[model samples]
Target: MRATAEQLRALRQEVAGLERWQAETTPRRMPLGHAEADAALGGGLEVGRLHEVFAGHGADAASATGFAAMLAARLGGSLVWLRQEQVGREGGALHAPGLSEIGFDPARLVLGLLPDPLTVLAAAGEAARCPGVGVVLVELWRMPRPLDLTATRRLALAAETSGVSVLLLRVEAQAQASAAQTRWQVHSLASVPLEANAPGHPALSVELTRQRSGPPGGPWQMEWDRDRGIFRAWDGGGAALSGPQLPLAAHG
Candidate 1:
C-alpha cells in the first residue's frame, strides 16, 4: 500500500536527521602527504567539501592554479574544470603536457571555457552535482559578484550530496565570506637547483589561511612530487629561496 502524506513527511524528516548526524560524526579526511600540514588540518582535507585557493599575487597565478590542480589530482577521479575565457588568455591556459608532468591524466579532464563568471559559476554548480565526477575546479581571475556566498553555499551542498570535492581557484582576489571547508594561498618559491644547475622541482610557499572544521595553520614550503602525485615538505637549504630564483614561471 502507498504511504500516507504524513508518513512520507516523517520519513523525509528522518532522512534529513540522519544526514545531519553523519555530517556531525564523520569526517572523511584524505591525508595530503605532508605531516605538518596534516597535523594542522587534524589529519587532512575532508573529502566531499569545498576548498578555495588564492594566488598570493598576480605573478603567483601559476602556483595558485597548480596548487588547486594538484589537490584535484590527489582527489583521484574525473576532473571537471571551469574557468573564464579571459583567465586562459591572461594567466596561460591549462596545458596538457604541463598537467602530464604532474601526473594528472589529460583524458580524465573536462575543460570548460566560459565567457564570464556567471557562466562559470552556473557550470560549476552543475558539475559539483554530477555523479562519477571526482572533482570540480572553478578558476576565477578575481572575486566576482556572481560568485557570492549563496553561490558557494549551493556548491558546498552539491558537493556533499554527490561526494565530490570542489576546488575554487581565485587569482588576484581577496578572501571573503564563503562556505568553503578550507582556504589557502600559494606563492611560487624558487626551487633548489638539481645536479648541474637543473631547476629544482616545483616548489611553492603555501599558507593555510582559513578553515571551518580545524585550527588554521601553515605557511609551509612545499614541493610537488609528480611521481607520487602529492605535496612534500621542501627543506632545501632550510630557508625560503631568495634573489632572482625566487620567482618561478606561471605554469608551475
Candidate 2:
C-alpha cells in the first residue's frame, strides 16, 4: 500500500516521540562510548541491576578489583564498598592515592569490613536499598555455599527497587550459577606506554561470559585512562591525542 507524503510524515513523528519517551522513562545505561562495545551491550551497561565481575585466576584478582572500582567511580553519587575481612587482608586495602590516580575521589568512598560472607551480603543488601547511593560494590574472595540463589536474588531485588547499581566482585573465584544481570571475567594485559620507557594506564582483557538481556560478548581489549577514569576500546597501541574522546559525565 502506497502512503501519502503527509501520512508518512505523521508516522515518522510518532515514532520519534515514542523513542523520546522511552529514553526519558526507562533507566539510563552507561556506555563506554566505543561503538562496537556499546552496540553489543544494547547501548550501554544497564543501571539498576546486579553485575558480577570475576577474576579468571589469582593473578587477575587485582585487575578485576580495579575494573570494578572504575565502574563504581563512574556511577558517581555516594559510593559504598563492602569487603570481606579475609579478602581485605589478602588483597590489601584500597589505597586512597591509588584511587585518585584512577580518577576516583577518595572522599566520596565509604568503606565497610565484614567478618563473613553472610554479613557482607547483608551489608550489601542494605546499601543497595539506599536510593541516594549511586553504586554499591561488594568484594567476596570466594562464594560460599551460603551465598546461594536466594541470597543473590535478594540483592538483585534491592538494586532494582532502589535503582542502585550493585557490583559483586568475586576474586580468585571460579564461575558458578548466579542471578546477576551480567557477568564479566577479567584478566590483566600489557599496557601501552605514553612516552618511551614510561608506564601507561592499565589494560584489561575482558569477556562478558553471561548476560540476561543479550548474547555473551567480548574478549575485547580495553584500556583505562587514569586521568579520565574511563575505559576505551584498544587495539594494542597508545591513544591518539587528536580524536573525539569518549564523553565522561559527572555521573554515568
Candidate 3:
C-alpha cells in the first residue's frame, strides 16, 4: 500500500523523536571490576557511549592502549580498533601475543590502520554504528583538525544508536571539549611483584577527569588479572597516594 505524503512526514518525525529519546537515555553499565572506580561511575562503565582516554606521557602510549583494551574486553562482543598509522610507527604495532597476554582474544579483533586521523575517524565512525561490534577503539596520537566536537558528537550518536561502546585512545593529546560520556587520563604503573620476583599483572593508574552523568572519579590503582578477566582494586602495596578529589558538580 502506498502512503500519502503527510503520513510519511509523520512517520519520519516519529522516528526522529525516537532517536532523540534514545540518545538522551542512560546507557547500560557494566562493572569495570573495581569497587571504588565502579562506585564513582555509578555502577560501572557506560556501555553504548563514547569515552576518551588520554595518555599522560610520551612513554604512556602502551599503558593507555592497554587500559583501552581491557575496557573493551569487558564490554562483550567483537572488537573493532581503528588507529592512526603514525601510532604504530611511533609507539608500536598491536600484537596478537601481547593482546592475548592481557586476556583479550586476538581472533575476535578487527583492525584498521589508517594513514591519517581523518581517515581513522571515518573508519571509526562507521564501526561505531555497527551493531555486531561490542566496542570500537579509536587510537590516535595528538590533536587533529578533524577530531573536533562535531566529529565526536557523530561518533557518540552512532554509539547510542547501535548500542556499541566507543573508546577513543588519545596519546599525547590534551583534554578538550567533546561529547565523551567519560574522559580519563591513564599512565603505566609498576606491577606488583610475585613469587621468585616474577612479573605481575598489568597495572595502570587512571584518573577520571570528566563524566557527563556523574562526578569524576579515580586516580585509582588498578591491576588487570588476565586469568580472571577483571580489574582488581590495588594499592600496589602502597604504591599510590590518594589523588585530589574533584568537586561533585564537576560533571554532574
Compute each candidate's TM-score over C-alphas. Answer: 0.87, 0.82, 0.86
Q: Per-residue error at 208 for model 1, in Å? A: 0.8
The per-model lDDT (C-alpha) reads 0.88, 0.82, 0.88
> Please, what are the lDDT tens digits per residue for candidate 1 over residues 1-252?
599999989868866975886668675788889889988999899888899999999999999988888998888999999989987778887898989888899999999999999999999999998988999999988769998887998888788877889999998999989999999999998797775557878899989999897778889989989899888989876553443445468897
Instruction: Give the C-alpha miss distance for residue 142 in model 3, angstroms.
Output: 0.6
> Which segments of model 3 are wrong by more than 4 Å?
1-15, 18-20, 23-26, 239-252
lDDT per residue, candidate 2, 142-180, as tens digits?
658667777888788778777889999988777777789
Candidate 2, clashing residue pairs?
Answer: none
Whose lDDT is higher: candidate 1's or candidate 2's?
1
Cα displacement (Å) at residue 1, model 3 = 38
TM-score of 2: 0.82
Error of 2 at 126 (Å): 0.6
Weakest ten-residue segment in model 3 by summed lDDT: 238-247
